[model samples]
Target: MAEFKIVLSDRETGRSYKIDATGPAAGALIGRRIGEEIEGGVLGFAGYRIRITGASDRTGIPARRDLPGPARRRLLLSRGVGFHPVREGERRRKSVRGNEISADIVQVNAVVTQRGSKPLDEYFNRPEAAAE
Candidate 1:
């Protein structure tokens, strides 16, 4: 899979996530920019309405203005116009505007749940994981 970095931010709260795309979703997410949106996961399952504070590459995912159908709808709902982050477990039950995420937006859910992980900036800067 293609590897790239992601720097996400909250326009309202000023929080951010500095992520390394290690899966198939890498190229599809690069260069999204702040206030821009993308969709992931499933409709009923866990999902996100992210504003791209920063993106690393620009080859895979195209701009929202170029998308069509449900893909566009998902983007427009989660990322378009006035978008924000959803809560951890509320999922489809709660709207993005009403829910709150844990800590800073830069701390991705996966990375945070790992046995022992540091802050995104520190983890990226450091060489190894520390003890929990």
Candidate 2:
């Protein structure tokens, strides 16, 4: 089964929570892409909604939204997700994963788009069986 370390960022609190997803929960994330919205119920957030922001593969390559598929590619870039230019008009070829989520992905980054009745602080503070 595919497993992923999910980091959920709360815009209001400016705080982030870490959760592990595996089995069915992990299965729900497959084929999802950056900038896509997902139901919170899939990740056990119930009423809350999550938006995919970014992801990293097992090899630590960051996924780019502009890319089309789930394969890694070396692209010449001016400035973007995986590459940061120091000088003016500087560009370099860098390896970045495609937007699509796959089993090779190790980490998933998201932001809460909708608020549930309960605050995330109270939710995360409660100890529960997190995916291992």
Candidate 3:
């Protein structure tokens, strides 16, 4: 199951709460201090939901997935054949450095991790799915 981050803050006392994303209702019960009114609970920077409540018992939370973005892209780029600028007048091009790197990763994983074949498109004519 996916995890979410949650942040709770009291409007009256300025107290704050940070917790891993779970059922908001459950966390609200866990994170709220006794007799305190819940003001807000929201998702934290990594996209986990925050829940504010009136009870307090902050403690261990589970690990969360951190999706790779620009910094990771750069690190990945550096480890393989580098990316190239998209030149004007070019309609299409070779696999991106990331793509190249991914292919390499697939090859390596297949060998070392004993994973199965990385699925490749059997045909290019299929329509792309809209972003959900």
Candidate 4:
């Protein structure tokens, strides 16, 4: 069975939430590419909508939107998702995962598109229990 750690970003509040998806929720995410939108019910949040923004494989290779499949490839780039430029006209081969999600992906990044009737703070803003 596949497992995924979903990082949901709430742009309005500039806050993020982390949830672990297992069983059916994990299965539903497999094969979904970046930029695709899925219902929040899939992640146990009914009435909310989330859009996949990016994902990373087990080893932390970020999925690039311009790339097509689930395979990892090294591409020469001056500056982009995987590569960062330090000097002028610098380019190097950097490994990056494709846009598609697969079993190898361990983390998925997403942004909330539609909010449910209840505000998100109600869900994630619970106060921490005090330590005795």
lDDT of 2 by residue, 70-110 (tens): 99999998998999999999999999999999999999999
List TM-score per model, in order.
0.31, 0.92, 0.19, 0.92
lDDT (C-alpha, whole model) for all candidates: 0.33, 0.92, 0.25, 0.90
Candidate 2 off by > 4 Å: 126-132
Candidate 4 TM-score, true structure as reference:
0.92
Ranking by TM-score: 2, 4, 1, 3
Candidate 3 residue 35 Cα shift, in angstroms, is 24
lDDT string for model 4 (1-132, tens) is 999999999998798999899999999999899999999988888899999999998898899999999999989878879888999999998999999999999999999999998766667665551221
Task: Note the clash tally of each candidate.
Answer: 4, 0, 14, 0
Ten residues in a row with the worst lDDT in model 1? 94-103
Best by TM-score: 2
Better of 3 and 4 by lDDT: 4
Could you give candidate 3's per-residue lDDT for residues 31-130 as a string of tens digits?
2322223322222223222221211112221111121211123122222123334664434222221211111121110001111132111111223412
- List model 1 lDDT by residue over 1-132, tens digit each: 445545544343344555665555554443333344555331111234443432211322322323322121223343342344465433222112211211112212211111112243343454452442
